[model samples]
Target: MFAMLVRLYLTVAGLLLCSMLLVQQAFPYLFPDQYSQSARHEFSGELALLREHLRGVGIGELPERIAALNRSNPDRYSVLSPAMALRLPARVLAELAASGTASDHVSTEHHHVYVRLDHGDVVQISYDESDFPIRYIAYATVFAMVLVGLMIWLQPHWRDLERLRDAAARFGDGDLNARARLPGGSSIRQLCVYFNNMADQIGCLIQSQRDMVNAASHELRTPITRLEFGLANLGDTLDDRVARARVHALRCDVEELDLLVGELLTLGMLERSGPMPALERIDLSAFLRASTGVSAEELRIRSTHIEWELAPALKEVVVEPRSLGRAFSNLMRNALRYADGTIRVGAEAVEHGWQLVVEDDGVGIPPEDRLRVFEPFYRLDRSRDRATGGFGLGLSIVRQVIDRHGGEIHIESSPLGGARFVMRIPWHQPGEWRGRSRAPREEPAADAGHFEHSFHLQ
Candidate 1:
C-alpha cells in the first residue's frame, strides 16, 4: 500500500513539474505582448526611480552614478551608448524609444530593462535573480499537498484491494466459502462484487463435484458387493479348473474396483471443508513401530527387511493418530511395492517439530515427477500397470492428511539409493511435549541392514 502511494505521488509530481516547465517555456512565445507587459509592470517602479536618478546626473557623470547604484542594489546598473542600445531587437528598441522604458526577459530568471535619459544616454539595468529558494519551497508545498491528497484517495482503495487479495488467497487454500465483502462506497466495489461472484460459482462447482463423487462411490458399493457375491458362488459351482481360475480372476477385478471406490470415497471426504481431526499425544517411537509393523507383516512374503531409526530424544508428540497413521501406512505400502530388499523408517526430534522419513532401496522417482506424484490419479509412466501402482491416490491422500495437520511433505533421493518421503509435523501446542535432551546427534548409517532393530540416538 505504501509503495502504491509513493508511486502515485511521484508520478503526479513529475507530471505536474513537467507541465509547469512546458508552460513556462511556451508562455513567452505564445503571448509575447502579455509577457512583456507583465515583466514591465513588475520592474516599473524600480526602473522609474533609477531613470529619475540618472536624469539628474550629467551624461559624463552617469557611469559614476550608475556604479554607485550597483554597489547599493542587487540589480546591476550600467550606462550604454545610444548606438550600443540600438543593437537590441528592432521592436524592443522601438518600444524603448516610444515608451521611454521597455523590458526584456532574457530567461525565466534574468530580466533586462532599457531607459532613455534626456541627455540621449541609455541606462541598461539587469536583474540578478535570487528567488530560487522561495520558488523551490512553493514547489515543495505543492508536492506535499499532492502527497496528502494521494494518501487520502488511495487509502480506501488499498484497503479494499487488500481485503480482496486475502479473500482470494483463502479461497485458493480450500476455504470455498471465502468471499470478499467490500463497503458500498469502495472504489473497487465492482471488482469485489465480481470476485465474490466468482468465489460463489467456484464454491458451488467444487461442492457439486464432491457431492457427485461421494454419491457415486456410495452407489457403486451395492453393485460391487453383488458382483463379488455372484463371483464367489459361481467359483464354488465351477467344476473345470480353468473356469474356477477365471472366476477367481473375475473376483479379483471386482475387488480392485471396490478398492478404487473406497479410495475415491476417502479422497472425497478428505476434500470436504471441516474442522481438523482430534489430536492425541502418543509416543513417537511406538507409533512408528506399530504403523510399520502392519505393513511389514503384510509384505513378509516378499522377504523385505524393515529398519527403524528413532531418535531417543523423540518421546511424546501430539498428532491426529488416525489420519497420520493412514498417511504413514500409505507411504509404507508405496515403499513396499517398489523396494528391492530393504525399507527404512525413521523419526527424529527437530526444532519446533518432528520429522518422519520413509525410504526404499528401489528405483528412485524422476525429479521432474516428484511433485506431480502427489496429484490425484497421477502416476509415473513406469508405474502405469496395476501390479506396480495402485489407483494413484495414496500420495494425494498423504498430502491432504499432512495439510490438515498443518504439516508438509516432500520427496527426495534417499541415501538408501531410492526415493525418500519426508513428513515434517510442526509442534502442536495443544498437547506439546518438548524433549529433555538437546545433545547433538550424528546421521544414521546409510545401510539399513546395519541396524537389525530400532536404533535410538541419545
Candidate 2:
C-alpha cells in the first residue's frame, strides 16, 4: 500500500510538471492577436498626438514629421512607422489627437501600464512588465500541492500498516485475544475482517488439540491404575505353584500394559518436545560391542546365526546416546524375533555418514506391509493380533528416533532371503573413524517351527 502511494505521488508530480512546462512555452504563442491589437491602439494614439503637435509647430508635411519623430524616438516606441496611425479613419485619429484625454491607463495583452506626456503630449510610452513572473513560483506551487496530496492519501494507509504490525507482534507473542481493528469506513476493512477470522480459526484448532490430549490422558490413566492395583493385590495372595503361575501371568499383562501406556505418553511428549535430544560424539565400535554383549544371552536362546563386519572407519557417529541406544535395541529385538538362519549386523562409513545394516534370513516382509508396519498399532498380519505379545510400536519408535537424529531408514529384501533394515547416521566429523573393525562369529539357526510357536508366547 505504501508503494502504491509512492507511485501515485510520482505519477501526479510527473503530469503536473509536464503541464506547467507546456503552459510556459505555449502562453506567448496563443496571444499574438491580442498583443497586435493592443500595440496598434497605443501606437495610434501616441502617433496621432505627435502629428497634431507637428501641425501646431507649422510643419506642412505632418505625416513626414511624425515619421521623423518615430525614427528619432525608435527606442521609446513601437518599430512601426508613426504615419501608419493615419490609416485609421480620419475621425478616429482626430479623437485620439484631441486636446483632452480619456484615462491615464491602458490595458495591454499581458498587463496594465499607465502612460502620460509631461506636457501637450510630446511623448507617451509604456510597457507592461508584470505579464510573466518567475517560472519557479508555478513549479514551487505544484510541488507543495503534490506533497500535501501524498500526505492526505497515505495517512490512513500508514495507520492501517501500524495496526497490522502491532497485531502480528502481539499474536506471535501468544496473545490470542489480541485483534487489529480497522477504521469504520476504511478501504481495507475487509482485509482486517479476514485477519480476525483467521485468528479465530487458529484459536479453535489449538483448543481442540488441548482437549484431545486431556481426554486421551484421562481415559488411559484409569486402566493403568486398575492394572497396577490388581498386580499389587495379586503379589500379596501368591503362595502355591498355581497361585504363583497366575500371579506371573498377571505380572506379564501388567508389564505389557505399562509399556503401552509409557509409549503413548512418550508419543505425546515427543510431538511437543521442541528441541531434539542432546547429541554427542560416540564410538560406534564400543557402542555396538556393548549392545551385542547385553543382548547376547537373549539371542543365544534363538540359536540363530549372528555376524558383524563393523568398518574400521565407522567409529564415531553423532547421535543422541539414549535415543540411539533405544533404536538399536528395538531393531535387535525385531530381528531376533523373526530371523531364522542368520542375522548380519554391520556398519560401513559412507560419504555422508556411517551406514548400518541389520539383515536376516527369516520370512521377508511383504511389499504391501513394508510402509504400514511403521505406523503406531499397525501390524502386517491381521490374524496375529497385537494382544498376542505385539504392540505394533517398534518400527514407529525407530522412525521417530531416526528422524530426531536427522537420519533416514531404508527397507529392502536382503540377499539372505529375509527383511533388511538399513540406517544412515551422520558422522560427527570427517576422518574420525580411522581404526580397526570388530566383529563376532556366526551361530546356527534355531529350530524353525519351535521358534515360530514359542516366539509369540515369549
Candidate 3:
C-alpha cells in the first residue's frame, strides 16, 4: 500500500511540477501586458548607465573596473564587442555616461546583460543565477502535499468499494451469508445497505427452497413407506377382508404419492423458469365457460350458487391459454374448498387491463394469515384438518402464473364476506398472431420440472 501510494503521489507531483515550470516560462509571453506595463529594454538601460559611470569615474581601462567588480561577485566580465556597441542611441548613451550607479533592478534582478565601456567594448556581467531552483523545489513540495491530501480523501472510499466487491464475489460463489460490513458514516453506506438487503432476500429464498425440498422429501417418504409395508405384509393377511383392506390402503398410498409428485413438479416448474408464451386472442366469455364447465360437477354437487359478472366489454383478450387456464383452475378449486353455497366469479375492465375476481361466500381467510397462505406448504389451520387444507402450492402457482403474464393477483375480502382472489391482467390489442394457432409446445420438457395446481384433499 505504501509503495503504491508513494508511486502514485510521485507521478502526479512530477507532472504538476513540470506543468508549473511550463506555465511560468510561457506566462510572460502569452500575456505580455500582465508581466509589464511598458516594454523596457533592460540590457540597454544598464549599458547606457555603464558608459556614464565609467566616464565620470575617469576609468581609462575597462579591465581594472571589471577586475574590481569580479572581486566582489566573481561573476563579472568585460568583452570587447565594439561592432555591436556602435548601434546604440548616441544621445542616451552620452547622457548615461555621466551617471554613477544604475537602477537597483538593473544591477541585481538580471542574471546577464551587456554594458558599453567608455573604450567602446561591451562588458558582459551576471548579477544573479536565473535558474530559480529554489522556486521549483517549493513547487514540488506543495504539489506533493496536494497529492497526499487527495490520497487521504480517496483511501476510505477505495477500501469501502473493495470490501463491497469482495463480499459480492463471495456471495456469488455461494457464500449466501457474505455481507459488506461498513462502519457508521461510511460514504458507501447506502450501497452496502442495498447489497445487504439483496443478500438477505436471496438467502431467505434459498433457505425457503431448501425447507420445501426437505418437507417434500419427508411427505413423499410416508406414502411410499405405507405402500411398501402394506404390500410386504399382504400375503400374511390372506383373509379376504384383510387382503382387500390392504389393497385399498396400498392404492390410496400410490395415489397420495402421485399427487405429491405432481404438486412438486408444478411448484418446481413455476420456480425454475417462465412459461412458454405464445399469445392468441382468447374469447373471455368462451374461455370462462370452458374452465368453469370442467368444474361443473363439483359446483353442482355442493349446490353452490355460481354467479358470473363478466362485463360485455371484456369479451376478448390476448393471452397464453395453457398458463392462464392453470391459474383459473387453481383459483376455482381453492375457492370451492372453503366456500359456502355461493361462489361469485366476476370480470371487469380496469384502467390498463381487466380484473377477475374469484370469491366464495365461505369463511374468509384470517386477516393475519392471508399473505402466508400463498407460500408453499404453509397451512393456516396447522392441524389434521384434511378437508379444508391443501398442499399450500395453489396460490403460489397462481401468483407465479399471474406474474408470468405481467399481472398482479391480490387477495381481498369479498362483498360476500369470503376470501377473494383478484387478478388484474393487461390486454394489449392483438397483432397479426391474433387467433392464430401457435406451434405446439413440446411437453415432458416442462412436465418433469413443473408443478401442478394446489391440491385439496376434500
- In angstroms, the error of model 1 at 221 is 2.1
Off by over 4 Å in 2: 1-226, 229-233, 292-294, 383-388, 428-458
**lDDT string, candidate 1, 1-458, tens digits:** 98888789889989999999888777776877788788778878987787777666787787788778778774488788767887887767888778877777777677777778887777778875655688788888998998999999898888889999988877876778888889899989999898888888989999998999999999999999999999999999989999999999899889989989988988887787676656688988878778752554656777888888887888998888877888898898899888998899888766456778899999989877877899999877545556785888988999888777766677878888999987766777544323212222234245322221121110
| Candidate with the larger lDDT of 2 and 3 | 3
What lDDT does each candidate get?
A: 0.79, 0.61, 0.65
Candidate 2 Cα deviation (angstroms), residue 245:
2.9
269 Cα displacement, candidate 3 (Å): 1.1
TM-score of each: 0.85, 0.47, 0.47
- Model 1 gets an lDDT of 0.79
**Most accurate candidate by TM-score:** 1
RMSD of 1: 6.6
Point out the worst 10-residue segment of candidate 3 by lDDT: 449-458
Clashes of 3: 11
Give the residue spans of candidate 3 off by over 4 A.
1-246, 429-458
lDDT of 2 at 45: 68
